[model samples]
Target: MVSLSRVPQFTYQKLVHKIGSVDVLWFQHNSLDPELLMPKALFEVEHTTDIQNSLLKFQELRWFFVKMFIVADNKRRTEFAEKMKYSAFSELRNNKRVEFVSYDQLVGQYNMVSAQPSVSLLL
Candidate 1:
């Protein structure tokens, strides 16, 4: 099986809070209609950034993605956790599919997988 991750480059000029854009967006193509597609997941990288904006962007597109992730740095991770305590953000806190990934974890995972000598060539 061939799986690919599609990252959206175009700006979402239609969203209410058009401040931030999704860094990684994944989609699945229809077997019947080649042109028809649906979003599978989304990822936002927050390195020394605001969590509220990222959360808002994800909230707008939440219905489409089954899984969503917030990848943030150490400082941003703590900030995000604190910001997540709002009553209005209950949706995000209760969602089982949503995930938070720290920068250290992301780096460790990348390093672990790419540790092989041959992997460097592929990269």
Candidate 2:
């Protein structure tokens, strides 16, 4: 169940406002609260945009429990590392709250997961 910008009866209104319009936001449906949803992760796909902007967005939502990922080409890994050194981003860096995922790695991971047999296949 994927939604864009908004989710039907989402429970995290405050969080959504704070996060603004992130590239992707993963959520899990709450069985106990069927009408509401909980955020699981946040992903920012920066193919050519400034990496610091995405980092700043993550910084603002640092206290939240959601995982944060910056997806870009492998060549940008160094830039991501270098930007993390700034004092404004120290806490997130030191705590390892954010991660960098190469575009290839992300696709590979998706492929690998997709190749897995469905649970129903065993039945």
Candidate 3:
């Protein structure tokens, strides 16, 4: 289950891009582990906001490449807290709320790049 404490109050301006994928296999394959120490919602949200805004100023195409994906481990709540320190994405990568779409028909044209949130502006 997702730890509500770690769920941040996502802001519109902070969201760079919104990725819409309906592939369950891809999520399962690429999903990172959950953190142990679930960070406070405030902390996660702030981090996410900072991460999002930071990526908006880039003009190069190479920024699109994902350097690394974070996965939380079995340390429980603490794991999440620890992961947050190293998270490199615009939003917190919590496993619980990680949207899982099994059917492409429900979403868009089955494309992975429909409305992806901007992720190229992180440090």
Candidate 4:
């Protein structure tokens, strides 16, 4: 199994105060789909933090395309999603490539995550 902590390139995005929530973004990519993965990591974060921030160091990332995703599971997640929608602006209406799937959907792809968050990601 791949241990995230071992991956030196990965970093955490900053926390933004959009609504009433505090969100943290993590950058990741699918090696098989380098182009799509690279860009995905770019807009993944939009905040600044004392800890390592992924979005802030997007320039250092060397990949093809970009894709962004959110990671919030508590009461603040809704605000994060809303902020994403607001940020997309025109893309939200004109584009059809982006999607916002539940974390469960992601786990199902690998057969590692269940319907419940606690059970998913093998946490």
**TM-score comparison, 1 vs 2, better candidate:** 2
Candidate 4 residue pairs in clash (backbone atoms < 3 Å): 12-54, 14-47, 35-65, 39-65, 39-66, 39-67, 40-66, 40-67
Candidate with the greatest lDDT versus the true structure: 2
Per-prediction TM-score: 0.63, 0.84, 0.16, 0.31
lDDT of each: 0.63, 0.82, 0.26, 0.34
Off by over 4 Å in 3: 1-74, 93-123
Q: Each prediction's Cα RMSD? A: 6.3, 4.2, 18.0, 10.0
lDDT of 3: 0.26
For all candidates, what are the clash counts? 0, 0, 28, 8
Please, what are the lDDT tens digits per residue for candidate 3 over residues 18-122? 211100111112234343221211111122233333222221111332222222222323433443445552243432322112223223433433455442212
Residue by residue across 1-123, what tens digits does model 2's lDDT show?
Answer: 355555444546776776657888777777888666777788999999999999999998998878899999999999999999999999999999999999888877776666884522110
Candidate 3 clashes: the total is 28
Candidate 4 vs. true structure, TM-score: 0.31
Q: Which candidate ranks first by TM-score, i.e. highest? A: 2
Reference-based TM-score, model 2? 0.84
Residues 1-123 of candidate 4: C-alpha lDDT, one tens digit per residue = 332332233224321221112132334565876533222232232223321232223223322234434332344445544543544333432443223434554456447443444552422
lDDT of 2 at 120: 20
By lDDT, rank the candidates, best first: 2, 1, 4, 3
Model 4 spans with C-alpha error above 4 angstroms? 1-64, 74-77, 87-89, 96-98, 112-123
